[model samples]
Target chain A: MEKGILETLVGVLARPTSTIRSICQQRPIGWAIIVYLVASLVSTIVWIETGFYDLEGMGLPDVGMPTIIVGSIIFNIVILVVFTALSHLAASLLGGKGGYGGLFSSFGFASLPGIFVAPLAVVGMLPMVGALLSGLGNFGVLIWSLALYILAVRENYLVSTGRAILILLLPTVVLLVLSGLLVGLLLLSV
Target chain B: MSRSKIIALIIGVVIVVSLIVLFFGQEIVPPHPRVAIITLTGPIQGSDGGLPFPDTAITPELVRGLLEQAEGDRSIKAVVLRIDSPGGMIAASQEIGDMIKEFEKPIVVSMGDQVTSGGYYISAHADMIIAQAGTITGSIGVIFTHLNVDGLLEKLGIEMETVTGGEHKDMFVTPLTPERRYLIQRITDAAHDQFIHTVAEGRDLPISEVRELATGELFIGRQALELGLVDRLGGRQVAINVAAELAGIQEWVVIELAPPVPSLFDLFLGGGSILREMAIARLLGDEITLLRTLLKTYSLPRY
Candidate 1:
């Protein structure tokens, strides 16, 4: 039977290990995408409305509302796909067995914690300690998301916690090295 | 209940508690007395998106909108007009000045380093004008410049042909004709007359007296105070105090109003990519300032 979205969301935070295991097995890519997109949409709207991104002093150009919304969604989708691809590759390299559907669903569900923090973005607009609360709330959301990501890795591939962490760190390490090399090359050419 | 369910229930409870503490907590807070500060930085130009460059300068529409917001808000006891500009076009200055004059709430003008020409024109009608001791202000006059770049084109060995609907259509080309110059002078004089007349009425000085002092001369805050052009010589805090006194309020909270909702261009092209980083900065107030400094230090200069 398909799990209730709320029940699954609650499960993800409460019992992440089993929640991710069931999500991988069920391969509910559609539901995962919906949850991720809805959460992202709410957070992005709050981000714009609250003037968190409205620092004119930074001289960043503001695009249209539609563009921001559409561009952000497109970017989120792209990031999701890219992260899935990287994770799949890492899993295969590490000799862990997991299908693309399972990996995608598990990763998608991993983003649920981001939704809980969406309201915090709006709440953080309050005066006084609003900014600090917002920071802490965002930090909490990130930690939750990271934990979910690790659980997704471990359960989907049946890997140990240490191996799951290694798999998760692979993409970031690769990106940093590649960027550093590109920068070094440009500097050398100059 | 199983361990998983128990853990789930605990997590749910924590999330609920956080929501109450962080979200609803703001609503439970009491409102305080606030003095809204509307900043008018850069030149007071006409409008946006007309020229090759973007119109990042303060415009009449922006000023008018801010004045209306300040006027409508009861929480806002008084408004502070923080102006730092060398001035802009004539029509924009007049529109903004009229709006400020029409504002029912008490307003105090806080002049920055450069408040001259149109800047002075707008603030002259405010309830109180405060400037720093060394602030440049009171560039009381009007001017119109017509570029005669025909010689430069000739030096570059470039000849331009033109078609015109009327005789004076090509009048603005290099080497301004005598009739065109006379017409331009008349236009400048008319604008000058309007400026002095408004100043005289606003300052309660005679038209002749204003005209005598309005010779396109720049003055420091001390000189402006002596000449009765500006009411006081001080900075932003003093302006706030005066505004509080004028509004008959003993205690007040000073809050700088956010600039008008950023243009869409700002949303997408400008600050969009840095949304994540900016969110982090917004959460950590001081980090935003630090991030801005870091961005400025490393980012390539724009022309």
Candidate 2:
């Protein structure tokens, strides 16, 4: 019998090495991408609806319905595609054997943790400990997803754990520094 | 079951729970019988939020939005309009009054310190009116006032220039020309007739009796009741009880409709609005000056 999608997801979370190996071998990139995209969209709509972004220091307002839908789709697609592409590039540079398609499948499946993390981010928007909880929860999800992604990368490329981590962190660190610079410029101009 | 099968079930539960939360995020609570209270305490004008600053008054758009909300909510059995104002723009008053008249739910007007002129105009069409004994109401006519300042300009050695497409366009200039006075009276009389008819039909009183009371005379709540301008002399609680009885609801939650909270940007914008209000207050100097300015700003000419 074929494993159900839920079974595959549970496998991806609990047994990342074997799950990434199977996912890469099967190469079901389309289904994996759709799952990631849909989860991202739903979580985005929840974040907007719950007024989660109405916290201090963000300088963003409570976005409306149309903005939520359009912005979520654009932000999710761009971020997901860009991050997947960057991982593929990093793996290629590191002399890994996997193609862009396999890396995409591995990373998309790796985003399964977001489904659980999104609600926690929402809960963090509550009154007293809201900002701290939201930050901690999101940070926890990031660390968890990073761990899963490292395993997926390692399995997909037949690379060592150290190599997989290097592949993942290179693009992420560059993007963070670039975005920080951009934000700093904007603040100075303002 | 196997370990993978158990994990699959757990993941299924998580997915279902998350989906449920996302879909029903906005309206988590169920509905119940409610009476919406919309308080109008200042000059009624256009919709809220075209201005940079905050407004404490009822706008035409605000009242209509609240009415629409009450209408759509299955839990809302009735509406209570808590009104306290000397008067405001005729167009705004009529707009709000028309909405109140068209509403299917029972509405009771609770008059506070003062609900006269355009304020009365809006509330007259309600199912019932309740006023406090000390309330000043029943100013049923319209007035148009303007600043002449012709003598002041002349004394200051400033010659006033005028340009107009129509001969009557400059009627707002001081020295109170006879033609301008006649025009003003004609406009006020037409508006007065409309007011009288609305009050007469709404209160089920005769046209003649309404015309007698529509002489721009402000009356105390007790006097107004004696003259049939008001239904009862009581406060907000009595109005709420009467509204509940009319809507066939014994007990209901009260929903007060206020304007939405302003954005963070509004805190900065509020400064400009305060300066504008201060300028107007300075020009006002006293009650009569304030009244004159209000009439100039908000009075709508029927012509």
Candidate 3:
């Protein structure tokens, strides 16, 4: 039983290395490009409708809400191009076999889980109860991140989990730092 | 770029644009919690998903809701009940006060222009009760008011056409006769006893010590702080800064939950009443701070 467990563990770790290499062989950096493009687009659109685009002269350009609406489209397309370019390049380099249909659908897949958060946010509409629910709900992103990484490096789910978690930390941490800096600036201004 | 490449780019752009519309429809503007807020809006007993009212008078259930919110959230490490109420039902104040004590969090009280009677009773237990310089806090005791038209009608007026399980069931809205005054005082005294007990427990003093301060005096924010009624005289920013300092977190996320629904009645009030909206802002804003302040207080309840 112990020997079998050891084999399973080895397979889990080694599986991702092969899967990643194979995907890379098919096309280089395909997953990273898609993730960046989709995330940026989604974030932009969410912010704009939230009247975040109205936060002009507060630091960012005080873009008109309608203009922001239009910009969301443009920005999303920008992300789609850059992200797709990166992914296609990775796939081509790595010899992974996938079509544009799969690639595009894969982008859609990344966003599907985000809607689950709406229900939690709905509960969060309560006072403290709602806030707690929303916090837990937001953690769903971690789940989605894991899925995305595993989808890219499909061989060993365990290894994919680790890699996805580690790689995605880059963007999340950067966002945190950026928020921290913004907070500091606001504090200084105050 | 080739024609196919251009076409692919256009298609990608179109998809991004469409997705953007869906995304914008749900805009993700970040929340800014300006101050310490505890929401007490809505009927103390809520209805279904219909529009909730903020103007509904304060109730004990509302106080209970505030306490529970203050107790559970980590962001609310410290609290200042920004009360602008005339007071609420008798049982509500007492039970909410009880819940307030069970809270291990530091609570300060800030009375707006009108914290009186039962409002003052509830405020009595806070660590410090701060009232605006002109803020009125304390009717110093309890008294129930009712229009006694029974005798007025008996004199050529009609009586409140009614029946009751007990003689006192129609106590309120009945004539305040001498006998009725005694009865009302007796009822008020019982509730008053509970109120004073809360004061004593909250102040960490003997009932006698609380009684000493019960000369039915009301003080403003600065004076309240001096008299141990409130800790300081300040607004939302001060409360939030205090909580932040206490929590020892410089870079933590501060989240404030928005109200679930809007009031349709608010439409009749002419949507933009600055003063009323400011009050609403205070209530909703404080809950977020309570969440920060009560971090350890709400670590985990067994049940």
* TM of chain B, each: 0.74, 0.80, 0.59
Clashing pairs in model 2?
none
Per-residue lDDT tens digits for candidate 3, residues B1-303, read 554445445545654554544343234432323224553332121121112343454555445545655565534556556667665456556556666556577666656776665666666676555556666655455555444334434654334477788876755555567887787778767776676676666656588866666655665556655555555566655655555555443533343432223333332222333334444446656544343324322221100
Error of 2 at B276 (Å): 8.8
Per-residue lDDT for A102-165 in model 3, tens only? 4443443344344333334434444445566767766865565456444643321223445434
TM-score of chain A of each: 0.90, 0.78, 0.49
Candidate 1 residues B1-303, lDDT tens each?
Answer: 655556556755754564454434445654445788888887776664222133357788677667776776556889999999887778878888898888898999999999999888898789889998899998788876665555555755668899999987776564667898887678778888888988898888899999998899999989988888888888889999999999898887788875555444444334322443355456656644554544432221110
The candidates, ranked best first by TM-score, are: 1, 2, 3
Residue ranges of candidate 1 with Cα displaced over 4 Å: A1-8, A15-18, A25-38, A41-45, A48-82, A90-96, A118-127, A158-190, B1-38, B47-56, B61-79, B102-106, B160-167, B174-179, B243-303
Residue A147 lDDT, candidate 1, scale 0-100: 86
Model 3 DockQ vs. reference:
0.03
For each of the candidates, the C-alpha root-mean-square deviation to the true structure, in angstroms, is 10.1, 9.6, 19.4
Candidate 1 lDDT score at position A87? 83
Model 1, C-alpha of A188: deviation from truth (Å)? 18
Candidate 2 lDDT tens digits, A1-190: 1566666877888777887788877777788877778667656655654444433213245456777677877887788789878888888888988877777777788887777655675464343465578778778878888898898788888999999999998899989999999757743542
Tell me the lDDT of model 2 at B122: 88
Native contacts recovered, each model: 0.04, 0.22, 0.04
